[model samples]
Target: MVLIFLFSGIQAYAVDPEVPDSEEAISAGQSIFNANCKTCHRLDQKLIGPALRGVTDRRELAWIKQFITNSQVLVQGGDADAVALFKEFNNTVMPAHDFLSDGDLTNLLSYIEFGDKVDPAAAAAAAGAEGGEAASSGGGIPNEYLTIILVVLVIVLVLVLVVLGLIVSVLTKYMNKNDDLDEDDKAFINQKTDYKGIFKSDGMIIIVTAIVLAFVVKTAINGLYTVGVQQGYAPSQPIAYSHELHAGQYEIPCQYCHTGVEIGKSANIPSANICMNCHMHIQNVEGKDGISPEIAKIYDAVDNNKPIEWVRVHNLPDLAYFNHSQHVVVGGVECQTCHGPVEEMEVVSQYSALTMGWCIDCHRNTEIDTQGNEYYDKLVQLHSESSNDALKVKDIGGLECAKCHY
Candidate 1:
C-alpha cells in the first residue's frame, strides 16, 4: 500500500498543475525564447549556454527562478550550483533577466516542457500571424509619400525657373524699346542674350569636352583597378551550410568551427570532423522528412575518409598577406567587422570590397584596444604621455606596405 501511494505521488509530480500546457503558453514561450534566449541557448544542443530542453527537470523551480533572475548575485553569494556552472562555462557570465514577469517565466517553462510535442505546421502558422502583426505595428512614412514629395518639389522648381526666364526676357525687350538705346546696340544686346547660341559656342564645347574627358578617364581607371575585386561574390558551396541557422539562431561562436582563427594565418575552412561533433546525434533537421541531404554529405565524407571541398568565398590577391590571428586575437577585431552580418546570411557571400582603399580606411579609423594587452601597454603609455589623442591602428605602422604585402 505504501509503495502504491509513492508511485501515485510520482505520477502527480510528473504532471504539474501550476504550469499550463496550453498552445497559447507554448507560443508565447517560443516568442520569448527566440527574442532573448535563442542567441546563446539551443533546445537540444550545447551552444554558448547549456541545452535547456530538460533544464527544469534537472533543477528545482525556485532555484531556476533565482538563477535566471540574477546569476551573478548567486555566484557572488557562493551558491554551489551557480559557481559550478560559471566555472564549467569558462567563467562566461550569464546575463540576468530580472525584467521577465512571473507569467512570462511560467510560459517559458511550459514551452520548454512541451515544445517538442507542438506540431511544426501549427507553430509556423502562429509565427506567421505574429510576424504579420509585428509588421502592421511598425509605423513609418511610406516610400511612395517621399517619392511624391520629391517629384512635386522638382516640378515646382522647374515652374519657378521658367517664370524667371520669361520675366528676364520681358525686361530685356522692354528696356530695349523704351530706353535711349540705338537699333544696333539693341541687336547686339539680343545677340549676347541668345543662351542657346552661347551654349553651342566653341569655348563652351571645349570646356564641356574637357570635363567629360576627365570624368571618363577617372571612371575607366576605377573600373580597371576593380577588375579582380570580388565584392559580393557568393559562390554555391558543395553543401548548403546556413550560417544563419548555426551562428545567428544557435549563437555558435565564429572561433568554434574556424579553429585556427585565433592562432594561425588562415581562418581555415571547417573540416567534416567539426560538423560530426553536432551532426552525430542531430542527423535530421526539425521539419524535414528525412536526414538533410546537406548534413548527409558530411557523414558520407567522414565514413569514406574523404574531405568536403568547400568553395572559398573571400579571397585576396596572391601578393597580399593576411593573418587571421593578428586581427582576430591580438587586435581584437570582430569577424563581422570584415565579413559583415554573417549570422543573417543564408548563403555566405563577400560583403566588403576588400580593396586596398578599404583596408586603409579601416586601419585609419580603428582604435587599438590597449587594455590587458602587454604588447601594446608601453606603446599606449608613450602615446598617452606624448599626446591627448587616442592611439589608432595607423599610429603603429598598420598602413606600412610591408604590413599587408610581402
Candidate 2:
C-alpha cells in the first residue's frame, strides 16, 4: 500500500496538467497556430520565442492566456516571469493574439502538448514515402541500364565486323589455292579493295545520300518536337533568392510564398510585404552582423513602393490554358509532381518540359484520385463497370483538346 501510494504521487508530480487529447480539438488548434503562432514559435524548438510544450505545467492557465493576449501589458505590469522572459529574449515583444478565444487557447495547448508524438509506424511510413518519391522522380531508362545497352550494341557490332573479316580471309585463301581459276579472276578477288573507286561508286554515293537524308529528317522532327520546350531553363532573377535555404532547410510551406497556388489560376508571386513579415524581424541569417544583401533589395522595393521584377522561369504559350486551382486544390496534385524537387533548387527552373505531349503523357498515366469526391463518384462507378483499370485523368476529359485550348 505504501509503495503504490508513493508511485502514484511520483507519477502525478511528473505529468503536466492534461490538455484535451481529442483529434478535433488538436486539429482546430493546428489551424490557429499555423496562421498566427507558427512564424515565431514552435512546440519543441526555440524560434523567435521559447518552446511551448510545457506552458500549461509551468504557469497558471489564466496567466498564460493573459500574456498571449498582450505580453507588453504583463511586462509593463512587472509580472516577474513575463518581464524575465522578455529580457531573456533580448526584449523581443511577442505580438498580441487578442483574437484567439479561451477555447482556442485550450485547443492550441492541446496540440502543442499531445500532437505529433513521434509514432514509430508513422515514421517508417514517412521514410517509405520519401524513398518512393526519389524513385519516381527519375523518368525512362536508368543510367546503368542505358550504359549496359550501349555496351551490348558495341560488342554486337564488333562481333559482326570480326566475322566479316574472317569470311573475306577464308575466301582469299581459297582463291589463291584453286587450280581451275584463271589468274585474272584470282587477281580481282585477291587484290586490295579499291578504296578510291569505292568512295566514288554509285552504290556508295546512294548509301551516303540515304544516311544524310535520314539524319537530316530525324533532326528536323526532333527540333519541331522541342520548338518551345524549355526544360531546365533557369533564369537570373533581380534578387538572389535561395529556394534551397527557405523551402528546403527552413521547411516553409509552398502555399506560404506562392499564395494563390491552391486558390486561383496563378501561383501569385509573393509581394515585398510578405518578405517584410519575416525579414523585419529576421534581418539576416543567423551569425551575420547586418541585413543580407538580397533581403536588402526587398526592403528597398517595399520602401520605394516599386515592385521587384522577378524573372519568370516557366512559360506556357498563349494557346494553352492551365488552372493551378484545378490541379492543386481539386485534383490534389503536389507542386513537385510538375515542378520537380523545387525545395532542393537554389534557383527556380522549368523542370518539366511543359509541352502538349508531356501533358498528354501525364494524363494517360496518372490515375484520378476519386476518393471522397462526389463529382467523381458517378464517373468512377461507370469507369469500373466498363474497365478493370483504375480511372486515369484521360478518362474524364483531361486530354480533351478544349481542356487546354480555346
User: How do the predictions measure up, each by TM-score?
Assistant: 0.44, 0.46
lDDT of 2 by residue, 262-369 (tens): 888999989999888898888778896445667767866775578988868788999999999999988889999999999999999898998899999999999988
Which stretch of 10 consecutive residues in model 1 shows the poorest summed lDDT?
Answer: 134-143
Residue pairs whose backbone atoms clash in candidate 2: none
Who wins the lDDT comparison?
2
**Model 1 segments beyond 4 Å from truth?**
1-229
Candidate 2, 235: how far from true, in Å? 0.7
Q: Write the per-residue lDDT of candidate 1 for residues 207-278, one digit (tens) a residue.
A: 999999998998898677556547777766778899999999999988899889999899888899998899
